[model samples]
Target: MSGDAVQIPDDRAFINFKNECNSEEGWNSNCNKSGITIWIQILRRGESIA
Candidate 1:
C-alpha cells in the first residue's frame, strides 16, 4: 500500500492510502479535537486500477 497526505484551507486535511488494485483506504483529519475518521473503498470488479 501507498499513502499520502495533504492539508487544505479552513483547518482541513486529508490522508489516503492506495492498495494494489488502486483501492483507497485511509482517513480524514479536520483538525478537530475529537479525532480522525477512517475509511475504506473497495474497487469494483471492472474498475480501472491506476
Candidate 2:
C-alpha cells in the first residue's frame, strides 16, 4: 500500500484519542508511559536527535 494511504491522523484526532485513553483507570501509569515514550522516539527521529 502507498504511504499516503496509511498516513497518520491529524493532531486533533491524536489528541482526542489520547484523551479517550486517559479516561481509563490505570491507563495513565502504564499504557500512557509507553505511548509517551514512543511519541518521544518519533519526535527524536524526526529531529535527528536520536
Instruction: Identify the leading candidate in terms of TM-score.
Output: 2
User: What is the per-residue lDDT of model 1 for residues 1-50, given as tens digits with 9 covering 90 to 100?
Assistant: 55776656342222233232244333333344457644444557997635
Clashes per prediction?
A: 0, 0
Task: Give the per-residue Cα lDDT of candidate 2 at 34.
Answer: 38
Residue 49 local lDDT, model 2: 34
Per-model CA lDDT versus the true structure? 0.44, 0.52
Stretches > 4 Å off in candidate 2:
1-4, 25-50
Q: Look at candidate 1 and give me any clashing residue pairs.
A: none
Worst 10-residue lDDT window, candidate 2: 37-46
TM match of model 1 to true structure: 0.23
